[model samples]
Target: MIVESATGRRTPAFDTARLRTAAERSASGVTLPAVLPATALTVSSVTLTLANRAFECALPAYACSPASLPAAMPDTGWAPEGRHGLFVRNHDLYLRARDGNETVRLTSDGAEHFAYGALSGMSLMAVPLMRSQSPRPPFGITWSPDGGQFMSTRFDERKVESFPFVEAVPQDGSWRPKLWQPRIALVGDAERGDVEAAIFDVAKRSKTVIALKDGWRLYGQVFHWSADGRSAYGLVTMAALKAIGLAEIDLATGAVRIVVQEATPKWGRFNAFIYSQPNVRILEASREVLWFSERDGWGQVYFYDLGTGKLKRKLTAGQRTVRDIIGVDEKRRHLFFTAGGTDADPDPYFIRLYSTSLDGGAARLLSPETGVHLASRVPIGNAAPGSATTAALSPDGNWIVESHSALDRPPVAVLRSARDGRVVAVLETADVSRVAASGWRAPTRVKVLSADGKTPLWGTVYFPPNMRQGQKYPVIDAVYGGPQVTNAPADYREAVVTMNPRSRASLAELGFIVVMIDGRGTPGRSKAFNNESYEVFAELELADHVAGIRQLAERFGSFDLDRVGVYGHSFGGYTSARAILAYPDFYKLAVSSAGPHNFQGFYPVEGLFPAADYGDGKNIRPNPAAVPPNYARLDLMPLAPRLKGKLILVYGEMDENALPSVTLQMADALIKANKSFDLMYLPNQTHDFFRTSAYYTQRMWDYFIEHLMREEPPADFWLEIAAPSQTTGY
Candidate 1:
């Protein structure tokens, strides 16, 4: 069968002969799986309907520092009229004001992917240009509270040099062009982006910097706004090399006071960025706030007093890691946060969300339900909570969106009252109706005791879509077991391609049982379970998931453990490799995509390498204690020959996150060990090549057609799907 998207892209299930030929061709000089094979397996792609774009907070949500709970929204991007809205355009700061007329445009220097903000109405912004990779200031634009006053970052980039990338058609069969130049600064050195914002007073129509400082090492202008609009707060970390200074700035006087500082520690340097992603700003505030600090043994949270620049209280005073501050209902006085592991040795593997009173109290365990993977936070209305609640809490704070799955589910998006965590209204259901329409089997959630005997693990079982209950089926354990990331209980669910269920889903669709377990290292369990894999990334968590697989298979007797398979990406890749190499009898087929195989390559930025890698952090959170060398160094290749299971490896050649080198480095060893396996290398793509629906569908289907069910899909099925074409290029 074949499928086509509305844009006319193709996904055709071709003959098995073609698959084998492609596989052999890829084997010539390429190190990884360069070609599809002409075996009985058929592989194709599927477009996914992923809700990646979101305004996130629907209610009165705070934009707190990632480490702490946010109390207020920065004046830069709020829609004044209503409390919530989204930035519809790029490079432009927009806020819904009280008036219903036109939306306010705070900055014109905005470009695609760039952002907008405000220190206050009176203070202007100094922005950096688009595609800028400099250690210079990035002051785009700013606005005041009432939304009347605005200021812009002052800069004259006329003197800076530029590196141009003239787009051209590919003549040969490659994405790399015949002509190329790297490191062309968008803003040149003569005075690399040295410009101050021209202030514009809404009342007087004035233009000037609040306090003029020409070329200081300040580059980032994070969020800042006074609740009353009388004052403004600003945070700037130099964009220059050795970037390690964060402070609370006075928008009026241009005076800088260090709220947090980083210095080289005993053995390493405190050389890392303060927040997670580029635009995640650390806000200033009080109450239910969480702060990230290295002061403790691990990265713990502390209540902060933005007014006094002091640590008012240590919320999570332990050795584990506090991942994100999800939400805080001040009126209710409860804090919502997610963590990976326990107080002793935090594992980066598992994660869970927890709730506690804002006035310092014991945390209420909410997620992980006991597995390595997780259950995400889903809350509904709470205009006010009186007495009764369902699911667990009222819609405002409590709700079990959905449980993690192995084959049948992606992630479930349900509306539940926070008062009792009961289901209210469901915002979205990933093709549930379609699953029923397609005769897909629904899985069940189960609990398995952990190997440690101290904790319990949770897992989801996907049965064959239309198979008899008493019949036995081969089981495939599809999982991703690492820290820093998670496989949601509810995510996208249209088959891997339009025709497959990820490894688990496809197998379930094929009359085989599919299991996905959230072992201790997986997220959404509890602070302790999520962090169990912190220092080490394997076995500790894998043992738990594997145990669940054994228990579940045994209980059902409908499971053919002798034909078990394991598959995953990145950390899951590491798991798959280990399953066949270490626990050969447990898994018969193993497939991995961009596994770390080595941790050295997972090094922090070069700047933070010394301090973070073999090093340290000044104001850094509790360190992982160690960062692995490149994934290749793990050398699963040596054990490949000793494996009793078949193996498949796939990776993107240009993956910045999981470099292709990780896979290539392991190939030499695998070949020397005379290991037999399949490989797929995507050119001109990056790590986690699932950005586009097409990319995701193709990668997913190809692997399954060959290994899981041992059948071939279509070659031109992609061209026939006719899925919705995603918008790109203005």
Candidate 2:
């Protein structure tokens, strides 16, 4: 029920194996299965499409028609009409008819590392981290309006250096470890990968290469067709991470025209770009392009001439940040968007739906009841997962299904009028009465000042159930300090069992006051606030966390600050490990799982971390050779000598994203320093260790209880996934 981006802090799904154990102690007569069904409700409307025809049952015709609505082109090789498929095989592109067996070879030049439809560097890292079933992704293609042609990119990574991943236990049952070498363009590598785009004609069976030089890399770029389909547009970011340009491709000539370009001294990231929401859209009727930019210190929308690339006007201006362009009524010249910091709400992070004219004027608030109002509907066919902010407006752009929730509020989806924000109907309201009766408590939303005592910081606290006034509890900071995303959830899902059932609430149940903070340097705020930790990734923003906890201790007398502990995965893992090392006197213990101790050995994207204000403002440049001294300070190995608290390092032996080697380097450093620490390696597990999540959760729980609380963990209390019995309504 919460709105979050992919780059945000990771939330491990709560394992379902403990459902039986939890249900046994609940006072309410509610089963886990019963609660799940009640939370699955959406709008009472469904679209059934058969034989190229669609019917919207119990809904208006505008709800399901594509001709009347502006539909975004899918970033795949599938034809618009679904009559044929374009795919890559054996490093070359191919075309095949859906109803017939007629096949045509498009290109035969693709080979090895220079393959057609080769995954981007991010995708290459994501597949291993996600442990996807398919080793390859679909060909990223955008079909034309007529379905006669499509555009795609061919990846060139032959010049990129290769990194080996040796399988300790091969799936083929081989006695020796199998090695896999993937071409990863690490920072300082002279020859990084590039992408060459092409448009393929279905009938002519020919391809025309795009004529763009430089500024074209594989990651953070996807093509989309203009409203009229005569041209294709894409948001392109340079490899150096300092410039971004909106390029328009002429289908007939294959010439790329830069429509609008923006450069920054600091790193520029398309933080809002996704397949469902591309942050850039074309208004074909007016020959105007809608672009999202943060040049004004806040994310806002701007209008530009598509042909001349000249700024027409600023559609939005203020300290508020525009989260997404949810929908546009081109005929009416109105734009519907979601934004934060626009209203006078207690929590600045509370997002609300807004509408403003494309011609420019004051924006009118739509959902004004406070909290985070997400103007998104459940995605239908082939839509992206968690793509709630895109394609939610009904056809003709009159109605929107908005899901609203906050830290203490259960999610409720309602249908609202797009023209004037009026609630038409209440679609669903989550029933948490049973959960409340079962001793479930809502977390307290706490606001504190940053370490500087100037900027405000927000977070949440989960206390032990049935707490007494005079009792004190050990504090545990559940953190994710990655600059990419915030750690705290703004919705009622704080206690929901997602992937693994272990949550801050579950930890608090074990006699600790759990805290989740979205400290400084996280997104969803002003640009200055986000850049607080730039070039200081290794610092972990521990100063802000300490300041926040001290303020919370003064407000809540039940928090035992002396017995503080911290735990996180991925970047949070890096933070937790750094916390114990940087503030050993304050933090008693930490469980750092899969921390990127050394960024050089990690993903190639580390090149974007360094930013120095060379006076002109262009701070970020990918020059690893010039920053060897900076790397020395950023590396965690040198800080191992300062470790004084109990530290537990966990990693999946087969994790390819952070690589188990990174964790081993930390362990080796600690061993060389003659320090005592604990290490747990899960065999045959990937980055997330999905297969062994329950075991990992149990061990994490035990670590905090045994070390922080000074209590004995149950002897071999294994949380197992029990087989369903005949009476069990699973």
Mind giving the per-residue lDDT tens digits that candidate 1 earns over 1-730?
3322222233445443443343234334332223331222223321111122111111112111112222233332442323433242444544443334446544466543223331211121111112223322224544454454444553343443333222233334566553322222211122333445444444443344545232234443324454454444343333322333344545444455655444423111121113342211233344112444444445455665555656566666444556555555555766655565452323233455566675777777665333332333232222111111222333354343333323345554444344444444444445556546665554566667777876766666777766677777777777777654444233233223321124465556656677766676554334345446644556676677677777887787788777788777766776777777778777888777777665443323332222222323222323333332322234465566677777777776544445455677666667778777777766544454543335554656555555656677667666223335321110
Best model number under lDDT: 2
lDDT of each: 0.47, 0.70
TM-score per candidate: 0.54, 0.83
Task: Provide the lowest-lDDT 10-residue window in model 2.
Answer: 60-69
What lDDT tens digits, residue by residue, belong to model 2 across residues 38-85? 222224433333322333322222232211212222322557677776
Clashing residue pairs in all predictions, respectively, total: 174, 11
After superposing candidate 2 on the true structure, give the runs of residues whose Cα lies further than 4 Å from its correct spot. 1-77, 120-137, 172-175, 214-222, 227-229, 272-276, 342-344, 377-390, 432-439, 494-502, 538-540, 606-608, 611-627, 690-692, 721-730
